[model samples]
Target chain A: MAEAENKQVIFKQYIEGVPKETDMEIKVSKTELKAPKGSGAILVKNLYLSCDPYMRGRMRDFRGSYIPPFVPGQVIEGFGVSEVVHSDNPNFKPRELITGLTGWEEYSLIQKTEQLRKIQQDGIPLSYHVGLLGMPGFTAYAGLYEVCSPCKDEYVFISAASGAVGQLVGQLAKLHGCYVVGSAGSNQKVDLLKNMLGFDEAFNYKEELDLDAVLKRYFPQGIDIYFDNVGGDMLDAALLNMRIHGRIAVCGMVSQQNLSDAKGIHNLFNLITRRVKMQGFLQSDHLDLYPRFLEDVTGYYKQGKIVYVEDMNEGLESAPAAFIGLFSGKNVGKQVIRVARE
Target chain B: MAEAENKQVIFKQYIEGVPKETDMEIKVSKTELKAPKGSGAILVKNLYLSCDPYMRGRMRDFRGSYIPPFVPGQVIEGFGVSEVVHSDNPNFKPRELITGLTGWEEYSLIQKTEQLRKIQQDGIPLSYHVGLLGMPGFTAYAGLYEVCSPCKDEYVFISAASGAVGQLVGQLAKLHGCYVVGSAGSNQKVDLLKNMLGFDEAFNYKEELDLDAVLKRYFPQGIDIYFDNVGGDMLDAALLNMRIHGRIAVCGMVSQQNLSDAKGIHNLFNLITRRVKMQGFLQSDHLDLYPRFLEDVTGYYKQGKIVYVEDMNEGLESAPAAFIGLFSGKNVGKQVIRVARE
Candidate 1:
């Protein structure tokens, strides 16, 4: 049998500020279809790759960070849905469908079998595992129910409202009987959040003359829970507008991601005055809640209470542009790259 | 009986940016040595007054702040150690030493006697009640033990390390066997923190051209607990140097209190990457721990394990300058005004 040519997205170097598509390179390598002898390894063909805001952190050579930086001249790793072609593991056999951490390539020989989760549930698309049923969905779930501990009838505000996690956070808060509002960069995204995503109110942050004033208008009583996806001026404004005992789940700082120097949050004193709690959380920390999250979100999806919008790009060649597009808000929803058809 | 003359510090107007001595006025008024008729009030002669950083928030007319702004032309209120001269309440007697919220004046007729705490222990200076044994002390205790949940052998960093609360946080962290470092404004304060205060390491932040480099030098292993008293750039640097799962107690932002436009803090992305938790807390929220705190801190003081420094001013006339000096780092230790002899 002959080795197959593997097309992989390789990170060229550590990025300085905003990552351009040129920062990554597509390198064609060759891999065998069989797992190595005397190993619990599984070889899979990558079907879909997830492009998350968190990936930007991996591009920087930052020490003491949660995840390690991707090595230059290596295949960039991310969450992806894959189809098993060869297996030496008892848990996952050949032709089994799974989703977990994998390389952004045509094929990956996963050595750690425990890291890959078997996607056995029916009535769902495999790509949905990356967007609604995987990391982003679980992030929204854990951050809201565990971190925020939100109550009914409370006012909730979400930043980056049109993104994967924000869309779900808004929907979950609405289902909880809370008044939810979101802010996005574009008018189209604002419309998607309000009309398509079921937010009580949505505003284009770029269009607003003052974000603080816009938040004040939407939340007359003040925000009870702010699912902060963009952490610069939005976090500052949210700090000032937080109600007593308000909770801010620091999801991401996409707005400050590419800056050489981050924007300062001046209104942090309000945290003391209002007795608010602002905390940063990562989805990887709440892996224990994965089972419950999948069940609850799956029910919501079946009942038509949840819908995920995916911006799909065909082929591994498009992966660089798709990942780079995340910082610029060029993708409409959960950005995913299709490495192969299911 | 002839009425006694009472001098008071009155807030002249709400401050726009940095507060000046002229923002407050010393006014002479008259008070009888008795409570009003049918009023269950106690009359107290103010012995010592405290100048704390939180008072700056009250000077601004900004709405949605933690506490209401002080009404212009009214007497400014703050913590003070006082001697009761006349008491109509059954709980308090004449000459009973007490400490709590009091007007910055020669005497105050306290109508709400319930808000005051009777001074029980002796051998410690009653003036200590306003600093080491008062709100600042309790703030340090609650913020460290409760909010941060610091562990032994962990690295701890305290900003504004020579002030009332910051001083105690460093001492307590040292007692816990943690590697402690503090940042102060001047070389003298830095010396005080190292020589007198017993901090393992201390640095003059103003002299350091790069705060991040300074922190990296001090905390080579990275900070596990950051007691954030100065929230702008110091916080930004600390975030970069925080170890995994670090907790930041947002005690105060004395550096940012006077700015018209506060310095934007970048590098919050580290919070997610490092799984850090940054929370702001108020001393008032933890009053339930006062009795235990009094016992523990008093024991530390008796054992010579704890000591507090006081920067005492002569009279009510010095209160304005002392309060204004907090932003400029003029006064050393806990800024106290000795209105009269105990």
Candidate 2:
């Protein structure tokens, strides 16, 4: 066994409002670079860490949520692309690349090997395992296919359209022959959505005064499917412009996560008049479709039918800032922290 | 052709807030009680007129809704049980009993005969055609079976449980072997729900100021199915107490119909955390299930497995007050105006 210094980002305390870099502290601790004997654990050195909006929920002190809150003074845990260094578990071996739940540090002693999957180092970038081929991509797939049930030529609208999940969702819907429209916070993201990602149309929602009128203008016939990543006034606006039997996939509520009392949705009555179906889902719950998601998304990428955008932050020290940047729409696309090179 | 004075209820004007008795005026007009030749129409003598909560929506001058608004200074149109006095349409013969769309008047010359259906003079009361076996009943059937998709022994909750749709929904959920709980505005309605309607538990929402606490008390394990007829604070509260993968059937927003601006729902974020599915539907869209509903419900009534309650108002002149009373939760069950007898 070898001993080493592990650099980590620690959750300093539970937060109330929007997260800031001050809420986390960077520390260096000594650790044995080996899994304990007969512990059924595997130690892995993290390569890349994913920054997701759902992580904001873990910063709160609420116990009623689906995932437990991050404990004060503990190393912040998140999804990451890692390489195995030591293993006591039979399924994982030393030097094998894997992706699943890891740490915001140099190395993690993972006891939950069930969630980890062995990553084949093909031509595809290993960093994509935490972005396009990971949880966010699978989320887009399950939500668009299972929740929205997209039909050919149907009108689809997505908010936070340039974000990790929304970008993938728009591309998938486009590939499915839907007339896709997306709303982003900046004009740069909007330009990328239309020119680079091939969305039918894109708009900067920050410049729009009346979202309802804006939606009506973009979707003259009304939206048949709405992939909602930002839930607030945008959700209320989308509600009023839904076509009959429309489906809304409630993916993430990044806009409401900061407010102590979330903004009230006033136009839900439209849900009845339009006969809409609004459902919330998680990617973990639909892991049974993971194999299919990997096949379809990878196929699309290889054929150049789909393209992924990542905002890579170099070094483990950038983890807290990268995670915090997701709430403000500061990250242009999928936010990832590069911990170490292969 | 025969001449007669047709007593009719005229919509005074478009309403902004809650409906008032003065919003409608009773007028007597001359009429020829015969279907004109080549008109393919039927002249019917009105019997029973249903006063539904959804009728309030028609009082507003909104064209975006599924149904059109009521024309001011004209006869109010609604579902009714009638007798064909004269018929030029081959589908309906003279002197046959029927139920369908009809005017709030003594004699109605219905031009759209496509929506009309001839009724059999079964041993059941003719008024039941506008009530337990009519739109409200079918709404409960479709929302329960199709939207909620109840499973045996699942915890079910119904808001506005003493009203027409809620009462039937509670009964059907009970018949499906679900644990049913209902909430009503008055203690009397709660008594009726528990003792007469055979609900597992019943509560008076007015008595409990904290709706979320009351729901938590009644549904300790959280509600699996929520049949929501009232969509205000109760709906917001129900969102907080839903179980994982809960289904919420949005039947009618009786609570919101009266307001110019509906109250905002603040707890919709729970939809994501719980992975709940909330759907809005119209019974008219599921007419294919009507025959099945009629068979099942009629059989349940005959077998003493279900019961229906009606609050009947005598004469066509009473229609205005009965319809207005719905906003105040005045009617105890299915509200009906008995225009005439068979």
Candidate 3:
């Protein structure tokens, strides 16, 4: 059989501070489209790629991290939406839409068929699998419900409120009858949180001189639940304004990712005074809840009760810029890359 | 009837830095023992008083706290083991032994009986109700079991390990087959943690110049659970060396109490990277589990499976020093004042 060509983005080296375009490079290679006889594997054509802040942590050689470091000169693996072009495994067939850990390339040969899930829904945009309807959406759902445990009429505060997970968390809290508030880095993002996402109040942390003062002014009675995305100074400020028995669900710490010396939090004593419960979690840890998450979120989307925002980079070359924008708070909501359209 | 005389200790004023002996003074006053006809109340002779670090937070006029502030020239109230000398409420009878909120001096007239529990077990010393068998004991129990959820053979680290609550937590984790280690402030207390409490390892944090290095040496596999009594730097160090999904039960932060500018925790980014869960709680919040706790702890004590240590000061006059010792890490174990021991 003749070899088929594959187009891919390869990691040039480990990233430092803000990732530059030079950190990653596009490369083309040739591979057999069909798996060898007796080999159980499936070949896929990549449709969508997820651009997440957590990818930054994988770019560094950090000890005691959940995921392994992305090796230099390798295609970065992340959640992606794909179409099965050829399959040796019975579970996946030709033309079947699927989602799982896939490469940042035009084609991938996945040997572990069990790792990928066959997509049952057909009408929704395939790119949604990388954003609002995928890991970020489930993370927001699980963190808000399982960790934060919001109650009716409770005051909810979310940091990085205009980002993928944060936007979904704010909306979910609102659906649960909570009075939602959010903090974004830029004025444009703050406006998006309040106007587009229906947050009761939203603030631009950059514009707010004092975070503690801002929280106090926004939540006079104090916050009941806090969905933390940007850790560091924002987390310290949220600690001071939490009510007794308040819950803090830590989803991400995008702000402290690149700093050689992480910021110090001074107000932790408030944890004891306020009797707060601060819990950190990853979406992969709660995969059991995904089925329920998909059913509820899809229902919300179809009913028009939920709104999802995305900043879609047009091609594989723009993927690097889209991923880097997460640190500077450039993207308004879920950041995704449109590698190809089925 | 002639006015009844009452002897009590009153806070002279709000204190600064380490509380001094002169900051509080014992005063003799008169009060009617009878609850003016329709008032349901009980008069009791105080027997044992609990000197906890949480009281120090209340001593200040902090904006948000679980308990109310101590008013100037008023009796300080905390968990005490007492005998009812007189009673008008149906729940209490004269000569009944009870454990509840009581005055710092020799006598108290309690208006609320809801928070009080009748002491049924007479095999142990009645004074145990103020320490190992009471609120402090339950605080350690719930914080370790329910909050920490320690696994068998996991590395367990406890701060203030020789203190009342820490002593019980270490013993309980040992009973659950965990590899328990603790940090005390002095050589004598460190010896007690290893010898008396049966910890796998004990270190004098004061003697160790590099706490992080010390922790890494002791917990080579990393800490699975940290029972945090002294926060600030110790907590920061623990955060750096925590295993994935490690649990931190934030019962208190004694090290940061006296400082006007508390030390900042710089390694909290570990919460996200390691997916650690840190929660702060009050003993009163878990009152519903009191019966289960009482049964379990009492069974453990009777079976010789658990041991507790106490530093007893003789009179109410010594209460101030005993409490002050808590901030300085002077007391070896649970600090209790024996006002009128049986």
| Most DockQ-accurate candidate | 2
User: Candidate 3 on B246-339: residue-level lDDT in tens?
Assistant: 9999988888887656768888778876789999888878888989988898999889888778888898888888888888887878888888
Q: Which stretches of candidate 2 lie over 4 Å from their true place?
A: none
lDDT of 2 by residue, A1-342 (tens): 799999999999998899999999999998799999999999999999999999899999999888999989999989999999999999988999999988899999999999898899877889889889999999999999999999999999999999999999999999999999999999999999999999999999999999999999999999999999999999999998999999999999889988867879998888899999999998888989999999999999999999999999999999888888998999999999999998
* Weakest lDDT window of 10 consecutive positions for candidate 3 chain A: A31-40
Worst 10 residues of 3 chain B by lDDT: B30-39
Model 1 agreement with the true structure over A1-342: per-residue lDDT tens digits: 358999999999998899999999999989998888779898999999999988888888875467789998899999999999998888877888999999999999898778778898588878989999989989999999988998999999999988989999999999999999999889989989988999999998888888789999999999999999999888988887999989999988898888768757777777777878777888888899999999999999999998888899999999999998999889898899999998
Per-model TM-score versus the true fold = 0.96, 0.99, 0.93
Tell me which residue pairs clash in candidate 2.
none
Q: Quote model 2's iRMS.
A: 0.8
Ranking by DockQ: 2, 3, 1
DockQ, 0 to 1 scale, candidate 2? 0.86
- Model 2 over residues B80-187: C-alpha lDDT tens digits? 999999999888887899999999999999999888777887666788788789999999999999999999999999999989898999999999999999999899
TM-score of chain A of each: 0.98, 0.99, 0.96
Clashes of each: 7, 0, 1
Candidate 3's interface RMSD, please? 1.3
